[model samples]
Target: MQPLPLLSGADPTRALDAIFVNAPLRDYGQRPRTNDYTLPVLGMAYIATYSQRAGFNVAVLDAEAHGLGIVETAELVNAARPRWAAMNLLAPTYEMSARIAAHLAPDIALMVGGHHAKAMPDRILADPRMANLRTLVLGEGELRVAALLEDEQRRRELPGVLWRDPLLGTRAAGIPSGKPNPQMLGPDINALPYVNRAFLPQDPYQAAPTETDRRLARNRGTDLLKNAARTGHREANIVGSRGCPYNCTFCGAAVSANPDLSIRVRSPENIIGELDQLHAEYGVTAFRFVDDLFLGAGRVIDEQMAAFTQNRIGERYVWDATGRINVLNRLSDSELDRLVQNGLREVALGIESGSDRILKAMDKRIDAEMTERVAHRLVKHGIGVKGYFILGFPGESHDDIEATVRHIRNLWALADNSPGDIRASVFEFRPYPGTPIWTTLTDAGHSPDALLAYGDVDLTSDGADETMRQRDEFNFSVDIQFGDVPLARVRSTLATLTREQHQRNQATQGAAA
Candidate 1:
């Protein structure tokens, strides 16, 4: 079905209960056009589905996917005439989201949530643009949102929710002493309804290939061709789990940063059920797990893999997922083989830095050596590796960055000799609110406004012009120097690496031709 009419005005008699909006990253007209792939907002879909199951009329508006600008987005939302206008906020898209929220009809009671909102509730509440914001949902939103939709009067009594009191200004309801109330931690993962994708546009969303996928296609013929000849290449992002248990200093979603979030995973059966549904209903043959941890550690991975194998999922579809380096390192070779046999295409690893010193500073437990070992093992088992690296951390030195460059080279060499591929996905570090590094920088006298002043990163610029189509493949940094390295040096390093990767891709394509 076509996406629900976005600009069409709603009927006066049938106003929507709630409308979840995924705001655009920036004004497309103000920036160079980028070929960034857009996906349906899964978070919004989840919350909408849950609210719908509770007998509420909910709709989702994806301004980003539809490429709607601030004014157009606001118009579409206003046209819906929702009683509540909910939008997710992120650091980079803060300005855009705020502008959209500001333009929303005053009659609509606004509710904002997400990592950025959770981190800086006071700043959001104080923003002049968000004057209509009635509720600021924090942590996991499904429960709090449903409760508020059911009865706005209970906003003050709901845990993980913040609202303005008539007499007392802003106040948190269920949260006590800055700790998550166990009573409001939402339901079991398996108990949550599958996200309703019908709310999304019917047209197939684009899925950009990874660096490894490009390399493999060049060397071993294009699987894209084969897939197109069969069921066609439809892809969807799936989530088998939620929350991270680790305390990585640079991550806003770190366990310590989000104390209200509890790490939870769905049962193997539940995961397989959704996979089957997507494959049947949407022709989704390719799945990318957007979970912080897809299969988890120890026996959890084994149990999930066994279920996939039993279901013959690998035979029907190929998938990629994120995993911890240390956890994968402990897996036996047979386990690795099983993963490959069960259609594990690539594993995204957060190998933050190559320097042990930098790793320790970022609270990333795995070192360069451990990262290399894990990459080699996964590649040997015919599973590709995507190593995520960060440069220019606060206090990071020139030597530390050089170590990261050398490490990237070593992994590339390892993939050259192995059957599987490897991709170095690197970025310049930018501090995010609520992360450990954010606290450190603030403690050192860095103003939050100044730190956040670096606006939405122009991914198409900054030496990424040639790889704009692959913009979604890697996170873009604001290029602001937060470390010992000069900003010029950081830009040069990032440009050089990006240029080399692009050249390698072109060369592989030429060779294949």
Candidate 2:
């Protein structure tokens, strides 16, 4: 809640082993690069928390939220003089990561991980700009970091760790191998410390309001007035689970990184315990589950729901999470009913496209019928549904785009409860280096790394950024229709949808009153 005293000056006496950073993303025109919608980097936060619990003095810094540029961030790290400095990686921040590593390396043992690093370990570790990078921690970092701290030599020995091969001389005969050893996964997540929310800067963060949020406010599902009072209160994110079983092509999570696609869930007690801490200490009344898939078929779902309802945790707060449509389909009607009755006010469904063909291409597994079924079901049970859609994949056609739009309209039509209760947001597809789509493109002889490095697909632009800019403005707001879809028609459809939803929202609100 208070400004970090460590920022003023690290305790000279304290042996600070590591500093975890959520590196600032490059500005994309009007949109500042940040950890998705102003959210804290819980991954970095967890690593910091676990490092501390492991008897290492660790500090977590969120450069984007703090508005610190690379130079300033590097200065702060240098001042702290930590033995190691690690940053979470995202594809958009690749250049930033390289620059930061270049500045902070040599002096500090630099490490990088997260989606980008996990997805492209060899590429990241091989990049000459990352010459100072001491190692790459793949997959989960909580245990690997602690192990590295306890035994500095383990950096080369640990599985899930890819360090510069020491045997090769500085002048490599060929390329240096940055492969990881076969090591054990970290201890169960239930045993790890809760994310250190209190250490975060007091400045509040909110993601840019989604199209869904704006519509839901109109429908009166979201309380616009109460938001002002809640704005300053800590709005936190916690994960009940890690990994999703589904193999969506665009996803860079377990599918891209872990491969096995094994899902791991924390005990409900552990999750609730963390919530209690946040609520009691920081008054975090609003929260979001950062889990890849928050709901599933069996005991985990039942226990979590039972815990929230029976313990009244849900009564104290309202929260939302992401889940696959099919997984939600697996829940009994009563189970889904229980979640909505409690605090499950919103759910983001990965209904990638309305076109079953496109959905299959994305490997979403669930089809148009299943998506529609789960969506209508959630709305019937009074849960707000946010559908995620994407366009501009490599082979996407005008018909595919129309199909997705049709699906969006169908979802909007199916929710009979209120206007704005059902909403869809469209994003242009960017083939990050490791996603299946990216791999597919790369295998077909297109270099995604080169394109991304050249700022082709990224939001940040230059004169060289022209080709990607031409490909489409590549805006996630879906404000720009990339293809044959008439911009005027698209705009008109959006306007009509908003107007209809507003009318329904007003009618619903009036009837309730």
Candidate 3:
């Protein structure tokens, strides 16, 4: 049970041919702007698989996942000293990614891709503010990195080049997102092979299990957390589908220059066919689907459902996914039964806030009542529903805080170990870049990114900096309420914690030197 030895000193072998680094959260404004941090380093794991499949050496550096600060991450990266280094991004780490890329620059073939890359490839690739990057993978970086390293001719002669052009400002007219090569179409999630099942985190899901007597996936399933913990496990993530059809204003569309407008659903045949071989041949089981919305868009949920029906493995395996409360609402009794029949273990929902006001502000579209209905329904079906609630938004008044508290209480009361539901989680909100609310919150004086998300406190008026620090690790220590009381009431003393963010914002704003 000893902690994994962190190289006590710098070890050069850490970086062999490639090194994958997840950046740090310099500022922790409640929940910083780490978009896909919860997501296991799937892309890196994919590259790890590709490298292993090709017989090269690889290592994954999950700085953010491990809570390593940027300096700590850089130290680890420097120790590894891989010739080629890459980082993943969503909006929160946009600036940090740039800085990390810069820190490891001049020597490291630094690269980054994620929502930021997908949403604004050119802007990021052509970024003049941060440091210069080696080359940003245009579309799916998994195959691109593999292709680049595997074939010298193909890597050099490849169709896409998303690097910066000093003279021209940025590279252009390259391989579009739709342009696919025969070898890796839809990522032959089958042929690509699984990474060594050695590198996943140990008991990562320990925090999220439902059944009290149920065993870990291995007793019945081998999951991502376990695989990620292994020293040399090479794994890749499979996005069963892409793009979300429902219009939740806070959610962004997928990557930049992505030609596909509608979300693409891979057949259960595609997934299971490959998955069967993946598990049989490569001993792979850990998979994290990157679908903004997993199943089918609206009407075509049938196509995906049928795929599962035809290719569905009766049992003995599983995968985790995100689901629209409403999309799940569409499932009939039989379909819901099928999900339970198969291994649909966990479902994450953006029950962002209990306050109808904040939900409306985020354009969540789903009301608190709907959230409760969907949550109760999922739990009833035995699907572990992890409700994601948020605090803070521009217009949230103190009363809205009470509304959120009520929501949590309602959720808590719903969990009855004696004979009922028993699973949940909560998060506070911070505006992310490129989103509409990011600008809205900035204009409204509640932008926490300045002082909260990143580390470092401002010791100005009334200990605002300390207050911001407290907010980052802030927990609901008291009891509070909403809706008259009892029966119709929710919980106590739990505030959404967003409006206080503006307080931090104001202090930072006032203290700007």
Candidate 4:
């Protein structure tokens, strides 16, 4: 397969059918430093490939991957002179995306889609900053985007599309009257093409630091070496599945939040084929499955592990994926061993809170006991654990946060004695639109605009030194506190958890030395 040409420079004579843009997470000039790694914008890549297959000339501009600011990104998109400009929007990056969209040529039709847009289509459509936005794609965008690009007359009637009507103002088509219809399903996952990396940046994406990398960096006493080592490894982000069945209150991807999203998974053969292509084409030896529910319960997990083993995926390349505690705990020792043999290096768990009350509040069925049990089992099998913890909830108490701190300590202790490593990623809760918590807060008189305006959390503080500020990008917290715990207390708790994580890393580095 011939690689598609990138939309890097201006060409006055050439006109692109569509140009997909992955907006920068923030204004680059404002931040002291950016995150160490930038994830590949696979969503844009998928849409671009699907559009290209349909005979539309397509290219991708990944502003986030290239560290382009809003102005430069807009300049590049304008330079491409594409008929349609498509951008993926998220809550944290909403302003950046909107600003970039505003800068595009007025004649270029703009389409916005992503979790934020899907959750707040009306707000996005009405926002004056994005007045030129032609349409808001509500759900999975491949089919709708292709339909939008190919036909003009039928756009207003396209399912899962929200467009403005001259007379009706903002109108929704093929969606239910009040909310997203749960019965509405997106395109079949297995039918889509493997994401074409030709549309992505040629350089390998930098990945999060691994335990071995950290150990080596600490021994060498230089952060530069660690970053270089991370960049040197070719890593790719893959999504084997989409839409989570769980309705966790804080999550925007929950079934309750995205009723139109139906859970779907690509076949093992399809997944392996993509892996093979990535390895062959770009030498990507490490892969991260960014799926919300990659390792599902019962038959789903078994079939995937069996297929991976048969394909000898682990032998060729190591991988990491998100897993459910209950589902992992259900796996027998033999099954766990097979997963390790198949090259399952680490599993990311959403251990939201330690208190059972808060867990019930968040609708996380698994309790601390289940998480601990699963952690022990995985570490025993020499698989690392990355536990995600949330410090505050709407009605969370001080004791609840204490319980969470204890939970992190317990998992760290489990890994301390075992071959596997444990990492704690703590965050202060921020409510996203359309999630259960958002509804709960709104019902209790919280203004939607106020919440939306809160924007990205500023994790850095004036008192923090450079080293602490460096950790800010890894941690996220908002100024507004919706939880019962005071905002200051929440921030303090976050600092404590973060400090503990650093101390543990240092201890491990010392032990290694």
Specify the highest-lDDT model's number. 1
Looking at model 3, residue 200 earns an lDDT score of: 37
What overall lDDT goes with each candidate model?
0.77, 0.66, 0.53, 0.76
Clashes of each: 0, 2, 40, 0
Judge candidate 2 at residue 27 and give its lDDT. 34
> By descending TM-score, how would the candidates be arranged?
1, 4, 2, 3
In TM-score terms, which candidate is top? 1
Ranking of all predicted structures according to lDDT, beginning with the best and ending with the worst? 1, 4, 2, 3
- Cand. 4 TM to true fold: 0.88
The better candidate by TM-score, 1 or 2, is 1
Give one digit per residue, the lDDT tens place, for model 2 in 307-328.
Answer: 8888876556667888778778
Q: What is the C-alpha RMSD of each candidate to the true structure, in Å?
A: 3.7, 6.6, 10.4, 5.1
Query: Can you write out model 3's per-residue Cα lDDT over 1-513, one digit (the tens) per residue?
Result: 122233221133433666667665452323353233354655566667676566555667766556556655666667565677766776656666776666664566666666567556766776664445656664455677766555433443444546665577756433534655644323545455544434433212333222321322223333443433232222234556645555454455523223444345655566676567656765544444656656535454566556655665434345556777667766777777676556565676777777887787666667888877766766666665556665444456668766776776686556432222334444334444545654555576654435224332222333233333433332321121112332111212222233343443344335432
**Candidate 3, lDDT over the whole model:** 0.53
At residue 2, candidate 2 shows an lDDT of: 32
Which regions of candidate 4 deviate over 4 angstroms?
A: 1-13, 172-185, 206-209, 212-233, 456-478, 510-513
- TM-score of candidate 1 against the unseen true structure: 0.90
lDDT for 335 in candidate 3 is 77
**lDDT per residue as tens, model 4, 1-513:** 222334632232445888888877666656534454556777778788888787787788877666678888888777667888888988777888889988888988888889898888887888877877877887788877887888755565666777767566766564434654333337888889888777768434645555644433333334443553455456788999988998889898889887767788888999999889988888777788988777766677788888998987866766789998888888999998888777677799999888999999999889999999999998877788889988778888989988999999989889877767788888878888889998999999988777766444543562324325444334444467776788777877777777778778777656645
**In angstroms, what RMSD does candidate 3 have relative to the true structure?**
10.4
